[model samples]
Target: MATPYIRMNGAGNDFVVVNALETAFRPTQEQARTLGNKATGPGFDQIIGIEPSDGADAFMRVWNSDGGMVETCGNALRCVGWLLLQSTGRDAVTIDTLGGLTTARRAGPDQVTVDMGRPRLRWDEIPLAEEMQTYGIELQVGPIDDPVVHTPGAVSMGNPHVVFFTDRLDDGFVRGTGSLIEHHPLFPEGVNVGFAHVLAPDRIRLRVWERGAGLTKACGTGACAALVAATRRGLTGRRATVEVDGGELQIDWDQATDHVLMTGPVETEGTGTLSL
Candidate 1:
């Protein structure tokens, strides 16, 4: 049978969303890969399954284009939240995922704000191969004496991420450096790589090479991780605007609660049905 699906994007990180609340459905890894194929199926950075939840408005199952099931995706959650808000006519909604539970609220006509829980800073949390200070890990690229990029901050916003703060945002630099560090021995689980340039105390220009999904236009968790990493290094304030290839996002790491809040816009591309 053909299952209905909705195509949505949050700040250019697009997804194919399946509402399984009424009729439960979960795609296998192969099926996910097929749907993510641009030439063959509905191309997307990730695929989200919105299933009924006992504890929250919905349970989100996320799969990357590579067919890997991941803990969470901030942009996918925001898109799902918007769908729930529109359907329930509520101002806010709660979502459950393998990573954790998060709450999303209406921020504007096409915008949603998600409260991504506290970041995990411990080596065991980011699950590095060994114990080390997450604030800055001793990893480098290029020559030993004059490395191109080094001393990146590591953290987990439900998923492992490492951010390299550098002046280099060139396409070749980001891709070359990001691809090398993504599967480095330090991160036990493959990590999402971020290349960021601090424009000011409250603004950053960022790019991300996502694990399982390479070089996305926008990555919600990557933006959150960037802000957190920058704040930890005393480079940026607790709150800032992150400019990604796709668009802009507002990220705030609450001092009191330690939760990161991401606000961004979501757009519906269209709707379609897919054979599962």
Candidate 2:
């Protein structure tokens, strides 16, 4: 039998969403990889599973195309929210992930706003091996002497991220630098690496090499993490526009609520069914 699935994109990070609520089959890493293989399978950056929630609104599970289980995915969550609205006919939807509970609201027909919760900045919270107070610390990667770009602001949006600020938006350093930093010893569990260029007090351009997913078109949580890091380092303000390869996202760090809000567009590509 074929299991029905939905294809969607948040910003430009594409995903394959499976409705696990009515299915008994749980996709394994191998299965997910087979489904996400661009050349031979379903083809997607990540595979998302929607299951019934215990106490929260809904339960979500994320799997990278490489077959690694991840804690969260902001963009996919928005797509999940849209699916929930379609199923329940509700404007506001709450979904639970291994990271935590996330709330999403439909702003327009295709626009969704998500409250991704507060960021974790402490070295331990960011889960660094050691303690560091300053936003910019010292670390070395390859032969890039005087790598002044080290010691980035670290944060967790239910996932780990290290953000480095640069002067130019299109600097080619991100691919090489980001690859090395993603596996730096400092992050025992590894981390997603983001290179950002501040275009204005309220705008920034970013590129990301995700921990398990490698480079993606866009990463919603990554944008939030970058904004938080930029604000902490005084590189940008509390709210800003994050331009990723795929599209732009509006991010706001609410002072009163102490949470991060990410607003962006989501598109439904097509729907299909999977056989377990």
Candidate 3:
């Protein structure tokens, strides 16, 4: 029999979701690669599995386009949240992931909000090769006189990220400099690289180079990282709309709770069965 699955997208970051809780479904690296093949399979940025959880409504297993299982995905979280809300008919849903426990709920018309929890600010938390300033860490690429990219802010939103405050999004910096810094020695664990251009106090234009997935249409965690980094640098206020390649997300870094709240939309393209 074919395996059953649902296809969803948060903004433009798409995913293939499966109900592991009901079917004990698990995709191998080869299987994931096959499914993400755009021309042939059900191409998506990542594959998410919904499994029974001990501490939350469900456990979200995340696999990057490369089929490597990672931790936490904000956009995917919202998609899963909507699923749980529909199935259980609840106002809210808590999801447990390798990164941590997160909760999501309905925000507005066809939109969802997720609490990403406080960020890990220490260099050790980002797990850089050694200790350094999280703000403007001592790392750079290109020539000494004029580096292609330099002085990025670092933070860990479950996983890890390095954000470069650029003047514009339509530049070579995103694709040109992203790959170099993604695997840079500074970040012990690979990282998502973000290029952000603050349009105003309440808005930011951004792009990201995901660690394992390369350039994606949208990156939820990357948006959180950019907002946190912008706040730390006093670029934008605690709340703002982060515009990504795919769409925009409302980000709120609450001072009282010290948690990042991300609100966005999820689109279900529908479901189907695949022989895996």
- Most TM-score-accurate candidate: 1
TM-score for candidate 2: 0.94
lDDT of 1 at 57: 93
Q: Give the clash count for each candidate.
A: 0, 3, 0
**Candidate 1 residue lDDT tens string, 149-246:** 88989989999999999989888888888888889988878999999999999999999999998899999999999999999999999999999999
**Candidate 3 structure quality by residue, lDDT tens digits, 27-99:** 7988777877776688889889999998999999998878778898999999999999889988899999999
lDDT of each: 0.94, 0.86, 0.89
Lowest lDDT sum, 10 consecutive residues, model 2, at 134-143
| Residue 64 shift from truth in candidate 1, angstroms | 0.3
Candidate 2 at residue 104, lDDT?
A: 90
Q: Model 1 compared with the native: what TM-score?
A: 0.98
Q: Residue 233 error for model 2, in Å?
A: 1.0
Model 1: which residue pairs collide? none
Question: lDDT score of model 3?
Answer: 0.89
The number of the candidate with the highest lDDT is 1
| Candidate 3: clashing pairs of residues | none
